[model samples]
Target: MKKALRRYWQTDFWREFFDTFLNISDCQNQPNLSHWGRKISVLLKEDPSRLRETCRLLRIQDETILQAPSF
Candidate 1:
C-alpha cells in the first residue's frame, strides 16, 4: 500500500489531483475492484482528458509496483 501510494504520488497527474483536494477517503468508500475505476470516472466527470492522463500515470505506477523488490 505504501509503495503504491508512493508511486501514485510520483505522477504529475496524481500530484495535481492531490493538490486539487482529492482525498483517499473518496476511494475508501468505493468497492475494491471499482476503487480506481470509480475514482477515474469521477475525475473524468470533472475533466475528461484528465482521466486518460491519470490512467496512464496509474499504469506506470502499477508497472513500478511489479518491478519493485519484495521484502
Candidate 2:
C-alpha cells in the first residue's frame, strides 16, 4: 500500500513538473525546456536522491527555472 502510494505520487509529480515546466517555459519563450524537462523526469525516476544534485548542476547551467528541487 505504501509502495502503491509512492508510485501514484511519483506519477502525479512528474505530470505536475512537466505541466509547470511547459507553462513557464512557454511564457519565457524557451526552446530548450523540453530537453531539460526530460532530463529532470528521468533523473527523478532513476534516483530521487540525486535529483536535487542534478537540479543544482542544471541550475548552474541555466538558472531560468525559478524553483529549485526541494528535499
Candidate 3:
C-alpha cells in the first residue's frame, strides 16, 4: 500500500497537483524537511486556510491519510 502510494504520488498528475498546491500555499520554502512534523507545522502555521483548502481539493477525508487500495 505504501509502495503503491509512493508510485501514485510520483505520477504526473499528483506531482503537478502537489507542486501547484505548495506554490500557491507558500510551502515551497520548507522543501527540505522530510518529517511530517515540520511539514504539518509549516502547513498549519504558514497557511492554515490554504492547507485546509488544499486538503479539501485533494479529497482527503477526516482521520485519513491517503493510501492506494490493494488490488
Kindly list the per-residue Cα lDDT of model 3 for residues 1-71, writing each as its tens digit: 11222334326645654775577646555544356456556645676775665566556543245464546
- Between 2 and 3, whose lDDT is larger? 2
| Alpha-carbon runs more than 4 Å astray in model 3 | 1-37, 60-71
The order by descending lDDT is 1, 2, 3
Candidate 1 per-residue C-alpha lDDT over 33-57 given as tens digits, one digit per residue, 9 for 90 to 100? 3665676576577876656666777
Pick out the ten consecutive residues of candidate 3 with the lowest summed lDDT. Answer: 1-10
lDDT of every predicted structure (CA atoms): 0.61, 0.59, 0.52
lDDT of 2 by residue, 7-66 (tens): 344686668666766677454565476776786687677986657655566665555345
Angstrom error at residue 4, model 1: 12
What local lDDT does model 2 show for residue 57? 66
Best-fitting candidate, scored by TM-score = 1
What lDDT is reached at residue 20 by model 3?
Answer: 52
lDDT of 1 at 25: 60
- Every model: Cα RMSD to truth: 8.2, 14.1, 11.4
How well does candidate 1 score on lDDT at residue 52? 68
Q: Between which residue pairs do clashes occur in model 1? A: none
lDDT, model 1, position 58: 80
Each candidate structure's TM-score, on Cα atoms with residue i matched to residue i, is: 0.43, 0.27, 0.28
